[model samples]
Target chain A: MGGKFSIERVNEYLWEIPAEGDMRVPARIYADRNSIDFLLEESRNKEWNALAQIRNVARLKGIQMAALAMADIHPGYGFPIGGVGAFDLEEGIVTLAGVGFDINCGVRSMVVSIPKGDIEKRKEELARELFESIPAGLGSTGSLRLNFDEIDRVLTEGALFSLKRGYGTAEDLEYIEEGGRIAGANPSNVSLHAKKRQLKQVGTLGSGNHYLEVQYVDEVFYEEAARVFGLSEGSVVISIHTGSRALGHQIGTDYQKVLRKASQRYDIPVYERELVGAPIKSQEGKDYISAVRAGINCGFANRQVIAGLVRKVFARVFSTGENDIRTVYEVGHNNLKVEKHTIDGVEKELLVHRKGATRAFGPGRREVPEKYRDVGHPVLVGGTMGTFSYILTGTAKGMKDTFGSAVHGAGRVKSRKQARKGLSGEKVIEELARKGITVMAHSNKGVSEEAPDAYKDVEQVVNIMEGAGINRRVVRLRPVICIKG
Target chain B: MNRNGHETLEHTADMGVRGWGENIETAFKEAALAMIGLMAELDRLRIKRRIKLECSEPELEDLLVEFLNRLLSQIDLEELVCVDINVITIERLGGNYCLKATAGCIKREEVKERLLVEVKAATYYGARVVLLESGIWEAVCVVDI
Candidate 1:
């Protein structure tokens, strides 16, 4: 019942949804006709109206240049999934919706020194052993039992705290964004309820889309970059995708109420109430930011514990130390950062919010770790259980055009209900088993919803990023053992 | 007890009401019934308290999510159980839409067993209301324990 959206081909791979009515900045989408067609189909069904939400986000206070949507954009709370937007630090607003409910929900990829043959030799044992050792399912608690004091340390230190606890190595911090910790985290700002939830679930894999997969380097696209990331063809790897579970959800709910009143106080006329936000400098905004940063640390710490479990599983199965499966890179896709970027040819501090998108700083970006500053940030794009995942490098073009951000994964194409209607969870398990991929999940629905058929082709999504010069492909990974909750 | 029915629907089994009807309104009504099933007699309750609430979400499914979450919050703050779904609407506003819902609660003496957990709210997880060609509605919602 709305006006038809007109399309303008900016390039072979880019399309623009021009700013017309109340839109302060234009909405730019990076996708070909096939991608856009899939997007339109999702939008037409009113399932993923993220394209419209992207336009609404463009109208946020202090927004910079333009609001961008990745090829994998889907409907989310405030900003659409796979959406990217930045705001000027002095005049900008940090809305919790832009970063999403699951704060710091990102991907962590580990490079193993061993080969796939070694893993295949003990495949079934390794699968069962990993499933039993690692905790999964809803409200699952990890091995670590943190007291209040240690909880405070985790909230403040992020992965570093886990590292000190002997869960991860110092080198693991090298490839992590902000070294597995978002700075300026004040544990005091976190709510008591959030702290209580975080106490028991440090290393747990919470339900709904969270997973731990043992993969092999199936192929290499950029040999030099792959080698730099310690990747060799057929080498084993591990990937963990989750976030600050209940802690982040609690923080999002808490701030939503806080910002609801802050919006009226600050006179922020939001296009949508879900985009409830206040100036970054406001008392409410500052408090929420602190809590969100702590949530990011918890996520980093969560992944660290998962890594430790992986190490233990390997130790029991292969007798090799977990340190051998070194951390390749870790990044939080759903997060907001105060990064300095050149906007309109002037250096400006901007609050960059990436939802369902990864920060892909190209070569020479100061944020890139010292060792690989010469190459670029390792962008981990994970796919569904039965599909292929990729490791890509940030490009200079990505930094200049899209604030150094790239798509996170192959976005979901169907709803969980639709997936269930089309396929049975039991059948999906059998299919994976026949394919030689050992699948172990806490719940059948979890496995079915994350069926490889429910998502867009990761190869296609990665191709879009590479073709757009946003990221360069490094290595491709195929799942060997998958654990889901 | 083949609890496959609970898994078939998107919600957990803590609250009463095994399944919900299709469509947002029916699903919401069924959820209200589900919540009330945890408290006193639904049939004997009168439309005494008419509290209005609204929630917004980016997607229709998320709208169901916010709707349940807000309901849970109200139940916790007011200690009231919704007996009826008077005027429930899920319309798309600019980017997100509002779920304008009205409900009533019965006095304590009129009810049987009290609900176990103060259902803080229903979330987006496993929330579904799909309509079939035969006009049958199927709905599910995972309530917060």
Candidate 2:
């Protein structure tokens, strides 16, 4: 990573590493001058070199346009987190690193129509209720204990399964990405072990950075777009951050071995050990994709169930109707999808891999909800337990360049070890409380490990994307209460 | 970080676990302990249940990952918090290396108040299994959290 490279400054907010030996396409990154310096420093220090990972992704077969990384780029296993790689559907490859272990790990935000002051008055009780009602932490299990067959239904029906069980309202589906269900998901492709892992984990939030936060709109950058998305300054909102639990983990484990073998069988170059994949047409590839889709569904169903629980808690605590909270939006960060994007003005379907990144379909896309069609859907950006999160919307320019992708969050600056050095859970809670944020966490070590100091500045990360004209800010949210697993 | 036994290494986003001993079996067992340490406060887990585990891979590096993933699956299935491992054998079976072991695991409820983080999987990235010139066999890998 430190030796040599063919990188050129394309603009103030963009850089391009042209295709060299074995690289099929150029690698593009959206970052300001300072962020670029930080990324290079990571390589120079031999920390996680996201720039090198992006370069390796450019080596993938049939990769469309250019391998890309958002401003929040950080080192991941093979593909850099906040990495985006799209490839021709017919000639592409499906890889484990592209999607990561927590398939469809995402954020779901709901607008809570209540006075922020009233909620703050009882913040301690609300935080405790949420932490208790929602099962969280390592190996936490939920109330819904489904058998194998029902797990399959959960995979195929997605949020519908949760809705049928009276976990959520029917109207909720309309606001979710893909209507909360992915059609190509075939449950048969999912392993029995994976289903077993999910039997009691459907609605549970797993540990390590996953959280349920109560926040309020702190500022609005674009008034018109904010109105369309139901955001008003000082309005309350709740965001759930989690994904398919052990089911997704098991699926990733099972598929990585299969795809690793497939890579050897198909003579696909193994750029990295975890970067192994198979041709899209291969049986192994098709099965892995189907399983991944099922994993995506598991993520939607999980959030739906958790959202229902959150709504019930709010209704009970504030003495208001559950319907008072409306779905703002739901989107996955780590995922794989087939979407049509124009390259050189030739619109065609391509397999898009967004790992630690989220889809930000621009205005006028049929996939976006009708009401927000003119202004594009909201891209929820989660900040740390003590920082400001933002709601961003895609732009036509974003679609043209990044295939409408945006950074997931403030990328990590320190390791878990470094973050928790001499830090304790009680100390973290005290720090957050000093900032007027309430935290309820199951693990003190986890609280310390995910301390705000571990992450890069989210506001700076979001501004880079806004400066790049790829994603525009709508509203900023400040955390009031956080329930961490 | 102790190289003679088991210790956790630091990675940017995940846990880097390593274990070593005079032989491969002990190294594999110590490695499992290092991974378990990342999930739970080991000394707090009291109740124990015995179970058998086995895994096979083409190379020792991969065998280490397979062995760790199998432990993860057991944790999900049995709500386990493993305290000790008895690696009965690490034999070369046919063209592949196979590891078989018996583990004493406590239910997660036993350490309900002391759990740390959920490990997603053991990854092949940055994984290694080496028999050092000092005659100590060491197994190392990064576990996705």
Candidate 3:
């Protein structure tokens, strides 16, 4: 037993909490021995813990295989960050905490024609130009000022609204998840307040953990997957991490009340406040899903706009053709989607909730793009701007073990207040510059708040997932320039 | 100790906010400040204008969340920098708890450096409103940053 929890080692890189105390299925965690020990220690000492949350998710109605936590597991409200819970279509429920407030907070990585050396030679100038070009940080507004009707189109149309409006090109949409938009988005399902929030926020890269980074491939672990993802040693890449901005958060706030009431009305057990869910068949559930889809679309649109901005900055800085900059892959970490997964030799449509976990469809899965199907689509796992990030591909074993989901980031090891203590933005900038990184930010405090030391070693977390045979690494990226919002 | 006070608690990812006062209304007001404090430097805010906010919810716990969320929307969507807050009323309207307050504020760009991290939204996770044995009213919850 690890602390008060009875955990059995399934393998070197896996642990399980047996089905007990009203749990419908066992809970599994992808972690090494050290990570497991830390999780159990947190579970024993903290009111909110990843192990307990995975157990609570397992207890939710209609949970299919098992409640799984990625190696980056950390305490989050209701559901743990890096948690994945898949539920049956008919008997299961959809939850807010499962999706989180930043409705599709995700990553979009792109490859530019210019080599890594070009970026290194002009890193500081490029950093300033990109930071000035992109609207970010607290209270920043985007270039688009949409009317009510236009905002509706963005909700329903996703990134296409901006593409038609000239934010980004059609080819940019080709590599994005769901072609950058889902079909279930209904404008009527979303409230006017949420719409108003989006009118000015459609293109903004919001503050708090969101970043626009420039990097180069520092190492390649799986050469085949790296080639499929368009990565090679010393190749320049740009990755943007943000989401639906204010609109997504407001939709979550608006739906939390509706879903909570629906949970009580439908007699679904509310194991935790944020775990409150409504039956899939209920009107409230349908509305929340539609709204979430719209929010997801907004995230796609925001990233699309920011990606376009990156292209413009490159075109100006390096004097390169804008079309030469191509999208490698874009995927959401916080999302809820309906997918058909096989369980016990039968395929069933399940609502998969990935909060701080990304969809990592295995090779040959139809969900993966045709060009990348042989190797699986790239899963962009972010790292603190000062650390090493990774690009990985899903494995066939992961498809059955954890619904083909993987970690989104290093995960925080310290609180924001704790992180900010004894840290200054100027000091952080100088520290990074000494390491050959250029840093620019909208808020100096935001830089200190996101200090690299505050996070677990991302390489270690990614190694655990790889060690478990769930994912295979594609390439390692080292930051050359980081723009914080 | 001050009769009304607020402090942001350390949470691994998001932040936990707690506010205590002699009464429930004061507690709710302080809770709003607790969240706002995370977003800006309150003392240095220009405080050039005023914002009126009202929210009604079915329970006290929800009322607190609604109040903080409404403020977050204003801060994010409307760019309001709240310097100070006062709770005017926390009355029961039939079966719902209705809250009305006005905040002394300035435009976000007025003194931009006063802004800190943006608060995404207030959540129900670990949320509670209770009267303690020490005769203090407290409201506590977590905010997604």
* Model 1 agreement with the true structure over B77-112: per-residue lDDT tens digits: 343556776536877788986778877764332332
**Best-to-worst DockQ order:** 3, 2, 1
Give per-model TM-scores. 0.81, 0.98, 0.98
Task: List runs of model 1 lying over 4 Å from the truth.
Answer: A1-3, A41-48, B1-29, B32-145
Model 3 chain B, poorest ten-residue lDDT window? B40-49
Give candidate 3 misplaced runs (Cα > 4 Å).
A1-3
Candidate 1 per-residue lDDT, tens place, A300-401, comes to 999988888788778777878857878888988999888888776888889899988998988998898887788897898888888888888888788888
Model 1, residue B48: C-alpha shift (Å): 30
**Candidate 2: tens digits of C-alpha lDDT, residues A1-485:** 44478788999999999999889999999988898998888777773478888998999998999999998898888899999999898999988999999999999999988899998999999998999999999999999999999999999999999999888788889999999999999999999999998999999989998999999999999999999989999989999999999999999999989998999999999877889898888899899999999999999999999999998888779876767888999999999999999999899999999999999998999999999999999999999777888899999999999999999999887888888895688999998899999999999899999998888899889999999999999999999999998
Q: What overall lDDT goes with each candidate model? A: 0.74, 0.91, 0.89
**In what order do the candidates fall by lDDT, top score first?**
2, 3, 1
Q: Quote the lDDT for A399 in model 3.
A: 92
Which DockQ value does candidate 3 get? 0.82
The residue ranges of model 2 lying beyond 4 angstroms of the native Cα positions read: A1-3, B1-3
Using lDDT as the measure, the top candidate is: 2
Best by DockQ: 3
Question: For model 3, how does the per-residue alpha-carbon lDDT over A245-300 read when each residue is reduced to its tens digit?
Answer: 98899999999999999989999888889899898878999999999999999999
